[model samples]
Target: MDIEDLHSWPDSVEEAEALQERLRDRVREEPGPAVVRTVAGLDVAYGSHSDEAVAAAVVVLDAATLRVVESAVAVERPSFPYVPGLFAFRELPALLSALRKLRATPDLLVCDGHGRAHFRRFGLACHLGLLTGLPAVGVGKTFLVGEHVEPGRERGSFTDLVHEGEVVGRTLRTQTGVKPVYVSVGHRVDLDTATRHVLALSPSYRLPETTRQSDRLSRAALRERESDPASAPPPAAAPRGR
Candidate 1:
């Protein structure tokens, strides 16, 4: 699997914003294949309060059956610190590993973070989509960018996520009376199509089945790795000056 260097990890908001704009130019936003048969979800977890991060990915059935197909996991050094507007640097390394290990190419990717919903218009989903050249959608739990009004109580309700006088994403209501998921285009898809895909995958829950299952799988795998003595390596010595 190909793993890019984490040396490009940004250390400041200005650097992060520049990187964000550069990344947007790298993504190709267009109408992708509408007949999606395979879908993937991406998620991450931390070890010992963010010193190290673990990433997990799962591919699943996108049709009415909703069955799992394949999955992968990875571990890497946490290069970027825990910053709100620059999460991509912290998680992208491990996530790239997990994605490379996947058995099949996914038709669509549902990321566990924002896309265009960012202060600089580049989030994990958008970055990954650009790096992989795959169609992706972001479903964030909280607001990282944009201003929007509250959606309706019923299912399938939504409003535009506006920022700087432009509609960048959607505040999607996947299930009735539940908190909405922030939907946005990562690459090779539009906001409307992204919202439709999220709803189609959400048969009985607030989150899409692919995303929820992947989240569970990621957490479970991290816990397993922590508990398994054989899988873990010996700890290194602490830094000399510390």
Candidate 2:
């Protein structure tokens, strides 16, 4: 899977914000693949002992069976500082590296972050979808920049997540009697379609298999990097301006 070099990496928070503003216009909120054969989950894990150290994981699964098809991980230091709305700048590079290592090109991407629901409407999932030219959805554990009425407890129930009086996403209940997840369109996918995909991916667990598996793999990769001296991360860079 090849990622498009859409823009240069931003070095400062101002630059990151500007980039997001420019690229946000390119995100297409339309129907994606009519028949998704495979789906990939993406996540990143940070080392507890070192703020700079992080691991990104991508797990591809057969959509019909929910069986693992391919996976990859990349361990590296964050290239940017931790800014509230500029989180993608810190993780995108590492996640792209991990994505490039995958042998399979997934039909859809499920990111553990917000997309159109973001403050700037360009979260990790949107950035990744634009770069990869793949249909993507963001299934966040918490709300980023939206307000929604509590959805019904039944699985498949959802309500519009509105930000600034615009329908940006959905607060979805993926499991009966479990906490809901936030779902948003990343790229080339509509909110209804994205919500359906998320529910299908999460049959039993509160989170979809794609997120659960990738999260576990990312943590494992970080643990392995931490235990091996040869794989130690470089000296942490000074925090950049916000």
Please give me the total number of clashing residue pairs in predicted model 1: 0
Q: lDDT tens string, model 1, 70-175?
A: 8887755566667887877777766776787876788888998988877778888888787777788999888787799999999999999999998888988888
Count of clashing residue pairs in every prediction: 0, 0
- Distance (Å) between predicted and true CA of 156, model 1? 0.6
Q: Model-by-model lDDT, in order?
A: 0.77, 0.89
Model 2 lDDT, residue 222, Cα: 90
Supply the global lDDT for candidate 1.
0.77
Using lDDT, give the best candidate's number.
2
C-alpha lDDT (0 to 100) for residue 95 of candidate 1:
75
Candidate 2's residue-wise lDDT over 120-155, tens digit each? 999989998999999999999999897999999999
Residue 78 in model 2: lDDT: 84
TM per candidate: 0.87, 0.95
